[model samples]
Target: MKAVYIAKHGGPEVLTYGDRPNPEVAPGEIMLRVRASALNRLDLNLRDGKNYRGALPRVMGCDIAGEVVTISPNAHTDLKVGDRVILDNRTKCGVCESCRMGLDQNCTNGKRLGVDLDGGHAEYVTAPAANAHKFPQTMSFTEAAALPIVAHTAWHCLITQAQIRPWDDVLIQAAGSGVGSMGIQIAKMMGCRVITTAGSDWKLLKAKELGAYEGINYRTTPDLSKRVLELTGGKGVDVVFDCVGADVWEHNLKSLKPGGRLVITGVTSGTKASMDLSLLQGRPLHLMGSGGRSRRTFADMMKMVRQGSLHGVVDRVFPLDSVAEAHKVLESREYFGKLVVES
Candidate 1:
């Protein structure tokens, strides 16, 4: 099978696209004819070996949508060969206490697909049979491929972690990002007023179209916290979904109302930030870091997608063989939504 693999941790240049040994289906696993895969910032970090190091020659892609090719004899699922499914990114030992409680992402033995195992950057891939969920007939493979990571992450951050309420004033950072695009729609779906930030005018315009009540151009408005305060009539937002990390850490703190919730998932910007203990204590804020969303969350988001309440925003699609170019486009941050690589 032809796949892209990283022989060593480095830049996009290290990605090799060529034929390799075809993956054989293992017991309790499901083999897939990979249809499409989406790129995430985690892919870039794993490629650079910044976090979650893996063995050499690892295929890298997390958001996968494909057709079932074969199911192991030991595995059981409602899906069968030719059924379209979305691969869950989070893998866990199902017998673990966390898994028993339906918190697969919190399992101590959890390993992410594409990070701990070879992922769907190829014509064929395999996943735990339990990780495959049948997608709606209305969803295209490209659309399903673009959803898992961002939708699950945003759902966990806003709904599960932040416990967001209707009419809450919410601020989402980097609205042009995959997660931010989903965050905007989810917040709006919950009846919250959403304010999102983007680096460019067109992205801000697009963010508004996706349901953001207001868009902030962070390039022009350096003190974005002040803008938040003004937009909120001096009270500040009730919840902040911040993925930019350290670069906007202080601003995120200041943009919140007293006791506001701030949930962070990614550190695209640098990871170090200085915070004032006095301000933290005075405001009694709830600051949380969320990652590795549970399978349940992914399934719930997919259900919303099927109902037409939530949608995946895809920016572009590249052929599977052109993964290097896809990486370049993702790194440039020139796209407004998720980037998909089709097999």
Candidate 2:
């Protein structure tokens, strides 16, 4: 099997594309022929040894869509050979305290596929049978590959955490990002008026096509909160779904209505920020962080996907051998939605 693995962390140059041993199906696990894998900022962080530390020679992809080729005989699953599916990268120990309490997202014994285990960047990969979910027949492998991380994150943040209402005015930061784009779609599906931000005009246009009611070019708009207030008739948004932290922290706080909710999932920008203590007491705002997503919420997201109300947005596709180039594009942040690599 040929895989893209990193033995050392530094840059895209550390990604080694070469032959590796094919993974064997372990108990309670299924081995799949990789069809497509999507890139995330986590991949870049892992590749560059930023914040994350892991073992060497780790395969580098978390968002996977593939066909089951082999299932361990002891695996208690209905999945069969040739079934197409997308995977939930997080694996939780079923007997953990949190899992026994039906809070698997908070399980103490949790391992991520692309981070803590070998992921689906190769010709084949193995994952727990419970993590695999069948995608709709109408969906392509590339589209399915794009859904796992971004869709799950956005769904968990907006629906489960923020509890977004249809009448709410929502603001989504970084419209060009995978989670940001998915957030716009999810918020719009709930009938919320969505205002989104991007670095460029074309990206803003793309965001509007995905259902954002208004788009702000943050590169030009020095005062993001002012524009958001203007868009909302000066009341500010009812909910803010932010992925870029620190850089937008103050603006996100100011752009919210009194008692509004703000859910943050990522901090691609620097993480440190100073918040006015007075604002917290005065507005009594609700601040939430998107922790690990639950299997229940993943199911909720898949239900929408199956209903055709939600779809993965694919910005570009690259071949398996061109993973380095794909990583470059991901780092450049020049594309909207997901950048996929086909096996």
Clashes within 3 Å, all models in order: 0, 0
Residue 153 C-alpha lDDT in model 1: 88
Model 1, CA-based lDDT: 0.90
Q: How many backbone clashes does candidate 1 have?
A: 0
Tens digit of per-residue lDDT, candidate 1, span 142-200: 99998888988899899999988997999999999999999999999999999999999
Residue range with the least summed lDDT across 10 consecutive positions in model 2: 48-57
Q: Give the Å error, residue 337, model 1.
A: 1.4
For residues 69-98, could you state the per-residue lDDT of candidate 2 as single tens digits? Answer: 999999999999999999999999999899
RMSD of each: 1.3, 0.8
Say which candidate scores most in TM-score: 2
For residue 98, give model 2's deviation from the true position in Å. 0.7
TM-score of candidate 2 on Cα atoms, chains taken together = 0.99
